[model samples]
Target: MKTPIIMIAMLSLSAPALAGGDMPVKTSTEVAYQDLNLATAQGQKKLSDRIDIAARRVCKLDNSITGTRIRDRDAERCYVAAKERANQQFAAVVEQHAKGG
Candidate 1:
C-alpha cells in the first residue's frame, strides 16, 4: 500500500512532463494564417497584404545575402534563416491577436 502511494505521488509530480500537456503552442505564421482565415473579407485582404510584404522582404534579404550564384548549401542556410524569422514574426502576431490587441 505504501509503495503504491509513493508511486502515485511520483507520477503526479511528473505528470506534466510526461504528458506534455500545455498551451496550444502555435507559430506566428500559424496565428497570422488563422486570423486571416477567420477574418472578414477585408481583414483577410489586409493580412494577405502583410504576408506578401513579409515574404518579399525575406526573399530580397535571402537573395542579397546568398547572391544570384547561390549553391545548394547557401540556399539552405538562407532558407533556414528566413524561415526562423518568419516563424518568430508569425508567433508574435498570433500572441498579440490572442491578447485582443
Candidate 2:
C-alpha cells in the first residue's frame, strides 16, 4: 500500500531572563500525522489531541524550579508565546483538515 501523507510539526519557545538567564530554557512539542485520511474529522481530532498532549508534556513544570518567582514569571510568558506559535503554525493545516480538502 502507498504510504499516507505525513505532516510533522515541531515548535520550541522560550526567552532569556533580564540579564543572566540560562539558555532561554526551550520547551517544545513535535507531532506527527500519518493517518490514512487526515482530511477527515476523526483524523484531525486525533492529530489535535496528540499535539495538545505533546505541548502539555513539554510545558510541564519542573518541581525543582516551581517555587522560584522569577522562573514562574518566565514560565508563564514562555507558555503563552509557545502556545501562540503552535497555533499560528498549525492553523492552516487544521483548517485544511476540517474543510476536508
* TM-scores of all candidate predictions against the true structure: 0.35, 0.52
Local distance difference test, candidate 2: 0.53
**What 10-residue stretch in candidate 2 is worst by lDDT?**
2-11
In candidate 2, stretches whose alpha carbon ends up further than 4 angstroms from where it belongs are 1-21, 61-77, 95-101
Measured over all alpha carbons after superposition, the RMSD of each candidate to the real structure, in angstroms, is 17.9, 5.5
Query: In candidate 1, what are the lDDT values of residues 1-39, reduced to their tens digit?
Result: 111000000011123444797543222222135435322
TM-score of 2: 0.52
Q: What's the distance in Å from true for residue 47, model 2?
A: 1.4
Candidate 2 C-alpha lDDT tens digits along 6-81:
3323233333442455444444546666553566677766766665666545665332464554445444555555
RMSD of 1: 17.9
Model 1: weakest 10-residue lDDT segment is 2-11
| TM-score result, candidate 1 | 0.35
